[model samples]
Target: MLRETWAEIDPGRIVDNLRAIRGTLPAGVKLMAVVKANGYGHGDLEAAEAARQAGADYLAVAFLEEALRLRAGGVTLPILILTPIRPDQAELAASQELTLTVTDAAWFRELRKGRPAPAPGGRKLRVHVKADTGLGRIGFRTEAEWDALVPWLAAPDIDVDGFYTHFATAGQADTAYLERQACRFAELMERCKASGIAVRHYHCAGSAAALRFPGLALDMVRIGAAMYGYYPPQLTPPVQLKPALSLHSTLMQVKRVRRGEYLGYDNAYRSDADEWIGTVPIGYADGWSQRMRGADVLVRGRRAQVVGKISMDQLMIRLPGPCAPGDRVTLIGRQGGERITFAELAVHIDGAAQEISTALTDRVHRICANEKEVQCPWSSPYFQPHRREATVI
Candidate 1:
């Protein structure tokens, strides 16, 4: 690819991680791979393919557009859109054989009002009813609200394929809130059963819940972060996961800064002595935040500290010795027997690995090493040169 700075995606690792997560589920439990947000910024179609090959029973995305993209890409697995779809988009979603989520009964009625009649011979619109046990975001918040929607869910026009909920604290050590949410969800499921509503799937576990509370893995578990080799710090995964994505870049330039010379914008760093500095072609725009200035990156297996203020498209690192342009740099991955993880970077930025992965911008090329394909968002064709140099300031 053209840019030396790109994300290397290991689909094999994703497959292994999916298998690992699958092993934790009980007999007959299904796995729903969450490939929304571009597969957690690892490339949606690639990750989805890997997960499916590794035995994912279903695929889920955040919106109808994502589901349609997967359909266009020839993905035949049952696809569910987790977020609520617009009333205008309902007919199109159904026509594409996509599953939509219903958060509130009133909203569902409104969605059907303007929704065009289903196409002749088209598949029924599958739907999953979400209950807001305690997340307080979307879904039916009270029992009366959820009960009112059950009868309508069984309408001939719609297929009530699933029922689900979300846990707000499944990853935390405290189980009080988690237990409460689970109890509420259980009560709702019991109500559904008593009302003779057949839900083909019942799920309440995301990555954290799947790992921390495997018992909550009812009919399926929506696997996301765990499939990418990360878990909440407070929770331990039953199976080991391999990181599927790594951020890498080449040393654009190397120069020596005189003692007392300033580095980067605002002169945020001053050299105490003549020091070697290496510039990398990545910055805040690439999801490498300015708050990561003090974080350490792997340079030839040695630790190099980010010294200067991170700019929009570049950042400076203090090198141990003279390093030349074209040297390999590891921003979030293993290199030369050393490793930098998203969790470590999260500690520096006070965020989670999911946040770090999803924050990656489209400008960065996604190189699927296993597939031997390069996914580029830039308009320019892929360019490659044996060697290239950047201007040294």
Candidate 2:
């Protein structure tokens, strides 16, 4: 039998985060759960369903494929594609009734190609206006660009439902720059209001805004990390939200290492004392970053140091106690009344620099935690937790 080295997705913890987020939202504001990066590297199906059930008004993903997977999995709630959809996928976007981002009029014209003149059934496709703001990403850079597309947005086929921009530094404490950016955004929104934009929602904040600057929440918020139980660098984490994903693996071996003995590639680490050297089955291929070489993990309620370079299939860790194989290693999540988070891991790699999910891959399996700890669903329902909402995929 293959040893289970998988991710445990805790839906109940996600539910708790949503409830806390809802409490923080204003009276008329709604939460748009960001399920992008495959729910921030936690499985999408589980994250989306949990967020939807916990009262999120909508779910947001990065692209058409991500949204499609959710729809195919029978997710019923509204999904917003935060990124621009490819021209070829516009019809698919139209068919699924997904809200898409329009950065320019060229993409808009492409969406009109195979689409009916009046739009089939006279139903409108939800559309959101994307402004570059300060992120300098894929969005209309100027008011002139938005002005050129105003008329087409009024067309019967497109429903210009919202206007949004990304926050570049709202996560920082005393974000004066973001404050000034928000003022500028206010001016732009005023201009849109003067020009009769008729936007259904106006938002400029994302995960950072959801936690750090609540006043900027506006009509709604697009959140990801915080919903996954992490806050910005500046904000204090509340007690209500708990991390939903925990990565655990069994210790493969524990052997005594002599002083001056080399470990791993290039003798990256040498044991200073005649102590226990342990191996964890997970490695860089499993998203245990190379920078996490000196990182810490909880083994048997005590912190164990990751020594040497992480290989594709294995990694060496230094143990402080008389440890044995089959003991659990906590990579991301709480253990022994203590918690370790992905954000902390990211800090070890690059503080406030790298996107944590970018390093994670889909190779690892996702199994429900607690319910069936004895069995992993590599070939069973523990892995096939598909909920149906749409009759046809």
TM-score of 1: 0.91
For candidate 1, write residues 98-202 as lDDT tens digits.
899997777667766775454555567789989899998888887788778876776667788999998998878889999999999999899878878778999
Candidate 2: tens digits of C-alpha lDDT, residues 195-256:
87689889887876776667888998987887777775446754456666677787999999
Per-model TM-score on C-alpha atoms: 0.91, 0.90
Deviation in angstroms for 234 in model 1? Answer: 4.1
Count of steric clashes across candidates, in order:
0, 1
Which numbered prediction scores highest in lDDT against the true structure? 1
The root-mean-square deviation over C-alpha atoms between each candidate and the true structure, in angstroms, is 4.5, 5.2
Range of the 10 consecutive residues with the lowest summed lDDT in candidate 1: 384-393
